[model samples]
Target: MLFFILTTIGKFLTKDEERDRELMARIKARDSSALSELYDNYNRLLFGLILSVLKKREEAEDILQEVFTKIWENAEKFDLEKGTVYTWIVTLARNKSIDRLRSKVYKEQKKQSTSLNDDDVFHPLYSNESDPLENTILSERAERVHKALNEISEKQRKVL
Candidate 1:
């Protein structure tokens, strides 16, 4: 009984690549701390990889946030037997960033407003008489989300 207890405690205390694998398993099982460790381990490298392609800081930052959001939301879909955690995350970041890049360009083109003298004209979404309360509510919501974001750990905050 004594030997069994000691071995159990010893195994619990050990930290290695296998521990990382276990953490990933926990993350797959819906543990949030494992998601934090996953972010701390790969955020910078993945961000740099995205920044290389996106070139714009804000766009890259948005892509980084989106990549990790998808990772945490989809952690259960990962299979350690198929690839290393690093490879899996990096691949996810790369794919998401590329998709963002493509869609961003499409959105920009769609939103372009031409001068009145030209064939196109800008038609605003809201008229000059639009309610100010709507704008105030949107601004307040943005501030609340920003404050809530600050409450999270730096590891999780980096991607955001």
Candidate 2:
């Protein structure tokens, strides 16, 4: 009886993994409906996890959206040998939230630095005023950088 119950549970888990794999395959094909289905299946659980990490509903919501956007973008990179779909997504949410927290701390430190003595302040060569010509050049440079990054393999990009 114990062997039969354990085998049945294993089969159920395998079926669940197979379903998640199929959803990921469809997402990689640019199927919006498949993404929607994935969101429907995982959003509540992911949201709870994000909310637990951030403790702010608004920021948690934003992170949840970012997590799904990442899922959509990186669907092709999923590997069964690495882990299940659930594990991958939960890791993404946790990492994103931690990043957001770190960014908030960095921004706070920057704000504090602005209050330092004039002699301690580090001045930049450039002004903050917007210039159309400079803006265009910066935009083009950003696009080039983005394209260059996309040309590299995901593993290499992650290492960078």
Candidate 3:
């Protein structure tokens, strides 16, 4: 009797294909409950994959949150026809981790200004100007990028 009951409970927990499908359907329909279920089911896996690539627990956790946020927002775009939900979540996690890695590297490099010369191309053409023409061009480019970036939704920009 004990064995039978235990086996029955185990099967109930793991063998419900309809339940999985239903949760996915709900997710596609923008159900918060479905997002909860997806997070409960896949967060660890995704986080583990991210930590593997990033080698930092806190960074991985942060990236995991961002990835799931995107997953929740973009659930409607998910297509089981293309691949399993596991694959999709893992891919999102991986991509976001790489993006974070690159961002961190960029920030570190930005903080360390090297090779500044009096005749640097970026030195301003005007005496009052802080930077040159090359610098002016780069600054303008940076400004345009900032403006373009401001046009994107905050949620979308978090990972970017």
The TM-scores of all predictions, comma-separated, are 0.55, 0.61, 0.57
TM-score of 3: 0.57
- Name the Cα RMSD for model 2: 16.5
- Report the C-alpha lDDT of model 1 over 31-138, residue by residue, as the tens digit: 988888877766776777678657888988888888888887888888765544554666677677667766665566567742232112122222456433233334
Give per-residue CA lDDT, model 3, range 31-80, as digits (tens): 98888987887676667667866789999999999998898788878775
Task: List where candidate 1 sits over 4 angstroms from the true fold.
Answer: 1-17, 111-160
User: How much lDDT does each candidate structure score?
Assistant: 0.63, 0.71, 0.65
Judged by whole-model lDDT over C-alpha atoms, candidate 2 comes out at 0.71
Point to the candidate with the largest TM-score.
2
Which model is ahead, 1 or 3, in terms of lDDT?
3
Better of 1 and 2 by TM-score: 2
What is the descending TM-score order? 2, 3, 1
The local distance difference test score of model 1 is 0.63
Q: Candidate 3, residue 53: CA error in Å?
A: 1.6
| Candidate 1 residue 65 C-alpha distance from true site, Å | 1.6
Can you write out model 2's per-residue Cα lDDT over 28-130, one digit (the tens) per residue? Answer: 9999998998898778767876676568999999999999999999998988755567657766886887678766655766888754433232222124665
**lDDT leaderboard ranking:** 2, 3, 1
